[model samples]
Target: MKLKLRIWRQSSADAKGRMVSYELDDVSEDASFLEMLDVLNERLIAEGDDPVAFDHDCREGICGACSLVIDGQPHGPQAATTTCQLHMRKFKDGDSIDIEPWRAGAFPVIKDLVVDRSAFDRIIQAGGYISAPTGTAPDAHAVPIPKQDADAAFSAAACIGCGACVAACPNGSGMLFMGAKVAHLGLTPQGQPERATRVLGMVAAHDEAGFGGCTNTGECAAACPKEIGLDVIGRLNADFRKAAIRAA
Candidate 1:
C-alpha cells in the first residue's frame, strides 16, 4: 500500500512546528504503524535526510510509548488500541495521514512526535502505591480479597498511562489516568492502608502537572486504549471525598 504522511516536525521544544509531507510506496498492509515509520526513517537516512522521531518500546501495545495522533484521533481511528498496535491496513492506498504528538499542557513536545510524559510518572510517584512492608512474597490467598473488588482492581490496572485521555479531552483532563491509578489500588486489600492518602496525593499531583479537571464529558474513557471506564473516575471522586472529610 502507498501512503502520504503529513507529519509534524519540530527541531526542539522551542522550535516552531509545521506539517511536512512525505510519500511512502510499497508499504505492506501488515506493517504496524511504527514498523511503517521504521521503513520511512530508513528511506530518509538513505537519502541523507533527518529522520522523523517517535517513541516506541514493546510494540505489542504493552508499553504505550508509541504515542501518535493519527488522522486527528489519538491512536488512529481504532478503539481500544494503541499506536504500536495500529496497522497500516486501517488506511487505504494513497491516503493522506496526519500525525501529531499528544497535545496537552502536561505533555509538552520535546521534538517531532515525541512529548515529555514525565508528568504522568510524577503523578504516579505522588501516591499510586501500596504502603505494605518490604519482605518476601506473601501467599496469594493470605488476605482473601473479595472477587468483585479483585476484578475491579484488575480492570482499572489495565491502564497504560498513554496520555491519550488528556489528548482527547476538551479540557485536557488527566482524570481518567488518575482515576485508574487510584482504583487499581483502592479496590485491593494491599492498597487499603494508603487509599485515602493515595487519592488525595495523586489528584493533587495531577493538577500540579497542569492537567485540567474532569467535567464528566467521557472523552477520556472513549479515547482510552485500555477501555478503562469512566466508572473509575466516579470511584476516584468518592475516594477523594472520603479522604477530604477524614482530613477535616
Candidate 2:
C-alpha cells in the first residue's frame, strides 16, 4: 500500500507546528500504524532528514502509549481500537492520512505526535489508589463482591488512561477518565474508606490539570478504546453530589 501522510511536526512544546506532507510506498497492509511510522522514520534517517517523533510502547495495544489522530479520528476510523492496534490494511492503497497528536489543553503537544500526558499521572496520584496495607492478598472469599458490581467495576477498570477521551471531547473534559477512575474503586467495599475524598480530590485534580467540564455530548465514551461508558460519568456526578452534601 502507498500512503500520503500529513503529520503535525513540532520541535518543542512552545515551538510552532504545522502539517508536513510525506509519501510512503510499499507499506505492508499487515503493518500496524506505529510500524508504518517506523518505516517512514527509517527512510527519513537514510535521507539525512529528522525523523518524526511519536509515542509507542507495547504495540499490542495494552499500554495505550501509541496515540495518533488519523484522518480526524483519535485512533483512526476504527471503533474501540487504539492507534497501536490499528492496521495499515484499514486504509486504501492510496490513502491520504492525517497523523497528529491528542489535541487538548491538558495534553499539550511535545513534538511531532508526542504529547506531555504527565497531567494524567498527576490526576491519578490525587485519588486513584486504595489505602490497603502492603501485605499478602486477602483470601478470595474474605470479602466476596457481588458478580454484578464486580463486573461493572471491572468494566470501568478497563480504562487504560489514554487521553483519547479528552481529545475527542469538544470541551476537552477528562470526565470519562476521571469517572472511570472513580467508579472502578467506588463500586467496591474496599473503596468505601476514601469514597467521599476520592471524588473530591480527583475532580479537583482533573480541573487543575486544565481539563474542561463535560457537557454530556458522549464523544468521550465513543472515542474510548476501552469502551468505557458515559454511565461512569453519571456515577461520578452522583458521588460528587453526595460527597459535597455530606461535607457541608
Candidate 3:
C-alpha cells in the first residue's frame, strides 16, 4: 500500500509547529501504524534529513505512549483501539492521513508527537495510591469482596492513563481519567480508608494542572481506548459531594 501523511512537526514546546507532508510507497498493510512511521524515519535518516520524533516505549498497546491523533480522531477510527495497535490496513492505498500530537493545554507538545504528560503523574501523586500496606500477601479469601464491586473495580483499573479522554473532550477535561483513578480504589476494600480524601485530592490536583471542567458531554468515554465508562464520573461526583458536605 502507498499513502500520504500530513504530520505535525515541532522542534520543541516553545517552537511553533505545522503539518509537513510525506509519502510512503509499498507499505505493508499488516504493519502497525508506528511501524509505518519507523519506515518514514528510516528513509529520512538515510537521506541525512532530520527524523520525525514520536513516542513509543512498547509497540504493543500496553504503554499508551504512542499518542497520535489520526484524521481528527484520537487513536484513529477504531473504537477501543490505541494508536500503536492501529494497522496500516485500516486505511487504503493512496489514502491521505492526518497525524498530530494530543492537543490539550495540560498536554503541551514537547517535540513532534511527544507531549509532556508529567501533569498526569503529579495528579496521580496527589491521591491515586493507597498508602496503607496490606502487610503480607493476604489469603485469597481474606477480603471476600462482592463480585459486582470487584468487577467494577477491575473495569476502572483498566484505565491506562492514555489521556485520550482528555484529548477528545471539547472542554479538555481530565475528569474521566480522574474518575477512573478515584473509582478503581474507591470500590476496593483496601481503598476504603482513604475514599473521601482520594477523590478530593485527585480532583483538586486535576484542576491545578489546568484541565478544563467536564460538562458531562460523554465524549471522553467514546474516545477511551480502554473503554472506561461514564459511570465512574458519576461515582467521582458523588464521592466529591459527600466529601464536601462532610467538610462543611
TM-score of each model, paired residue for residue:
0.98, 0.98, 0.98
lDDT of 1 by residue, 65-89 (tens): 9899998899989899999999988
Whole-model Cα lDDT per candidate? 0.93, 0.93, 0.92
Off by over 4 Å in 1: none
Q: Give the candidate order by descending TM-score.
A: 2, 1, 3
Backbone clash numbers for all candidates listed: 0, 0, 0
Please provide, for model 2 over 4-89, each residue's C-alpha lDDT reduced to its tens digit, 9 standing for 90 to 100: 99999999998999999999999999999889999999999999999999998888767878788888889989999999998998
Cα shift from native, residue 108, model 1 (Å) = 0.3
Off by over 4 Å in 2: none
lDDT of 3 by residue, 81-121 (tens): 99999999899999999999999999999999999998899
Candidate 1 lDDT (Cα, whole model)?
0.93
Q: How well does candidate 3 match the true structure in TM-score terms?
A: 0.98
